[model samples]
Target: MSLRRILKSWVERYFSDEEALILLLVLIAGFAAVIWFGRMLAPFFTALVIAFLLQGVVSALTRRGIPHLLSVIVVFLGFVGVLLALAFILLPLIWDQLIGLVQETPRMFASGQNWLDELQSRYPNLITPDQMQNWIGVASREISQLGQRALTLSLASLGNLLSLIIYLVLVPILVFFMLKDREALVGFTLSLLPQKRALMARIWREMDDQIANYIRGKFIEIIIVGTVSFITFSFFKLPYTALLAVLVGFSVLVPYIGAAVVTLPVAAVAGFQFGLSESFVYVLVAYGVIQALDGNVLAPVLFSETNNIHPVSVIVAVLFFGGIWGFWGVFFAIPLATLLKALVHAWPRGMKGRDERHHALASEESMEESL
Candidate 1:
């Protein structure tokens, strides 16, 4: 048969409904497998993300005429220094509070039991004192068991400290190499594609730009939120202010739920120490003001065009990933979602179709300036 006839027959066969269904099923199965594997490798993935973020810093340093090796060392040392400073400033306070809380656990349980007993005596229709005592006993036992398990894990993992050391040592090294060789990697990958598809390199570069901008903007936002939270909590004379502020900062890394989760614990402690009404109002107002500032001022100034995710999408991604993969999932949901959005935006459009529909507004600006 002629080449045109053969080509027509091949297209007809391959683009049939049955072929399309099979392709769809295969794609779905492949995606499921990838997700399962990713879940299993979550920790390494987390480390890689950390490295990816730091790679930009390393690149900047190199661009400033710093040697790659020295830049990596400086970045790693800076990270360690920050961690040490936080530990020195915050750990002692947290240790004292933790010790006090541990010592007071029995007292808290007794107080709870006493309250239950008084309620039983007043009503005589609620749970009997004996039942309340049994419930307390069960709860106390569970708490004791959980504490023992946690202690055991901590102790047993001391020998495994070397693994963590290795990871810490390797990440900066990997990041330095990645930053130094990024262009080469891109060129090598693109070389494998046909000339017709070589323009994908530009698309990939745009995607990388989006990811880098979002990550850098996010870090700045977290720092701003943390600083604001620390100042607010300190002014209010809240308990565990340092720890709570750190929690708030980390929560800001996640979207939507971060502020709420950070505030809840701080509010609970405040309520217990002060009074319910005062603590509730204080935390509610403090977080509200901070959030308002973040939304109106800080975000617009720093992350103006970086992350354009809808609030609904943020909530859904957090819930879905958090459910499947726990804390890391929640922590990474927004960045990962942002990366996916970038990829979708970068995907090649049909030759005769509308091509700008999926692109971010920032990319349009870049295009306009280039033109």
Candidate 2:
């Protein structure tokens, strides 16, 4: 084919499917809106996500003969209870530990400096004493700056306490109504669309199930892994158990990267507390077992092969969406990537010609039947 014909064919091949075009346009618009107004719409998005996560629970309760409204109310109350517990109970404990750690910062720095000095003594040519001292100086200065920045940010957050309160109030209300009026919302959304929406419907159904399962699975995984880590660390008398446990728990979210990155803190805490003793070895072994069980047992039980996405793809999705939406993006990267994959597979190829012929045949058949 000529270059012009080739260009025309390519454009027609991709754009000829009206439903595909519509889906693409809608995705682009939605993405643009999020990028433009992410902060302003964060609460609504968060509420929507919470509603989606709780939907299965609501359905389960309704199936057990509870009324739909009652199910929603129960779930909403349970959610609020959990949030209150975290805010008042769990957070205070974590914060106290954090303050303790900060107060012990000088000891940590001294220990680190001693280790560096030992290294310099062993390998005099590799790391000079002056270089070690300079490195320590830089790190100390950086830590000071970091502490100041953290305090400043905390103060800033306090200033935005009203905004946080608004979110706390508004989100639950949105989630409650969303769960209660889900069918009506779905119907109203569908009513705005064209009648011919088979492809869109199929894609929507697939994405709905995939996203829901993924979110629920991750939630369970975090709780299980974090609890296990906390118990294991506590048994070993490790300091900062809560902080480390939280890291280890959420680390499961990023697959390979999360575990590897979180290992550092666990190791550092263990080494600092017990040096090369058997307690350190025991702590490491316990952590290894936890990770192994999480990967082999808990994950298989909770998540299915539906998340059979390639490792490379998962990493790329992490980078891409994480860049766009930070933590939330990283949290949702895999499911979002799966949605894109489904869309690509579902998009019709050579649809224009097929649709035209099918409509023509239907028109002729109708006329003959009328006659």
**What lDDT tens digits, residue by residue, belong to model 1 across residues 31-58?**
5864788755544565566666777788
lDDT of 2 by residue, 1-371 (tens): 79999998887887787777787887898889988998889899999888888999999999999999999889989999998998788888888887877777778778778888888888999998789879998989977997897788788977678887898799988988899999999899999887877677878888888899888999999999999999989888899999889899999999888898898878877878887689989998999999999989998788785658888999999989999999888998998899889977767666665486468669989999999
lDDT of 2: 0.87
Q: How far out, in Å, is residue 64 in model 2?
A: 1.7
lDDT of 2 at 356: 67
RMSD (CA, Å), each prediction: 7.5, 4.1
Off by over 4 Å in 1: 1-47, 59-73, 83-163, 184-203, 277-280, 342-371
lDDT of residue 97 for candidate 2: 84
Which residue pairs show collisions in model 2? none
Please count the clashing residue pairs in each candidate, in the order shown: 0, 0
Per-residue error at 140 for model 2, in Å?
Answer: 3.1
